[model samples]
Target: MARFVKEIMSPAVVALRPDASLVEAAQLMRAQDVGDVLVAQDGVLLGVITDRDIALRAVAEGLDPLTVSCQSVCTPDPVCVGPEEEITTAQRLMRDHAVRRLPVVDGRGTVGVVTIGDVVQDRDPDSALAHISRATPDL
Candidate 1:
């Protein structure tokens, strides 16, 4: 059977309200051991917040994380993928957007996130993406 996004996705999502403070978002990231968090409103995805967003938009800007809202730093209207989409389509979307992660949505709204790492992990061991994704990051 052909692979699909939902078939390999982690199904673990860490999300927060847009009004949530950057500090709270950071706390959630820490607690969840995730690099990104979805900013949602009433179960609708509004944006995405990554550690990079906090670092560049808040910390580097000298803004107080506790006082600032995640909505202020998040990438608004982020690209998203459906659970039923083909993995190749997901990969193409990632490459086209130059983003490492894409929120997975369906009729139920945001369900999970699909990261390049997730894709790489799910790919065949002999696949080029798997080998490339497995490379260690520099300290």
Candidate 2:
């Protein structure tokens, strides 16, 4: 079982500048096969934008994705966890924030992302969510 966030986190953090367009962020997500992207500038953590944010906040509102900036729609100052933090602490933060993912930060910057799926997989590999998390994403 993973004892810390760094143990189970997906270390490849897909990030974009805050000025990046929603379309660009969406495209990045598609290319990365990730559901979310960290909005940053100069290696500073800014916000988090998710696929649902693009769909519900922009597309559903009839806003042009090309014109909408990620910073304008992203959840700003998102709750984060340290890479060295205990796995249970990450789980608690996720539960409290009602967020599915958390940015794993260290002194350097955002290093990774820990998702509920990661926690589930680490804590209970035989669970349905764990099984689903391990499955290959559909194209």
Candidate 3:
């Protein structure tokens, strides 16, 4: 079992500038096959934008993705965890905040992201979520 967030986090650190258009963010998400991207500037974490944010906050609101900026729709100052934080602590934070993912930060800045699936996979490898988490993403 993994004890720390870094052990199970996806360390890709997909990120974008605040001024980038939502379309650009979506394209990046497609290219990376990720659901979320960190909104940052000068290595400072500003916010997090997720695919759901685009669909619900922008598209559903009739906002033009090509014009709307990522920071405009992102969840600012999101709850974060350190790479060395215990898995249980991360899980608690997620539950408390009702968030499924958390950005892992340290002295080096945003290092990675830890998702509920990661915790599930590490804590219960035989669980359905773990199985789904391990499966290759469908196109």
* CA RMSD of each candidate after superposition: 2.9, 1.2, 1.2
Q: Rate the local accuracy (lDDT) of all candidates.
A: 0.89, 0.96, 0.96
Clashing pairs in 2: none
Scored against the true structure, residue 64 in model 1 reaches a CA lDDT of 95
TM-score of 3: 0.96
Candidate 1 is scored at a TM of 0.88
Candidate 1 stretches with Cα past 4 Å from truth are 124-139
Which whole-number lDDT from 0 to 100 does residue 115 have in model 2? 96
lDDT of 2: 0.96
lDDT of 1 by residue, 12-41 (tens): 889999999999998998887778999998
Backbone clash count for every predicted candidate, in the order shown: 0, 0, 0
Candidate 3 accuracy as lDDT: 0.96
For model 3, the stretches where C-alpha displacement exceeds 4 angstroms are none
Native-referenced Cα lDDT, model 1: 0.89
Give the runs in model 2 whose Cα sits over 4 Å from its true position: none
Model 3 Cα lDDT, one tens digit per residue, 1-139:
5599989999999999999999999999999988999999999999999999999999999999999999999999999999999999999999999998999999989999999999999899999999998898887
Sorted by TM-score (best first), the order is: 2, 3, 1
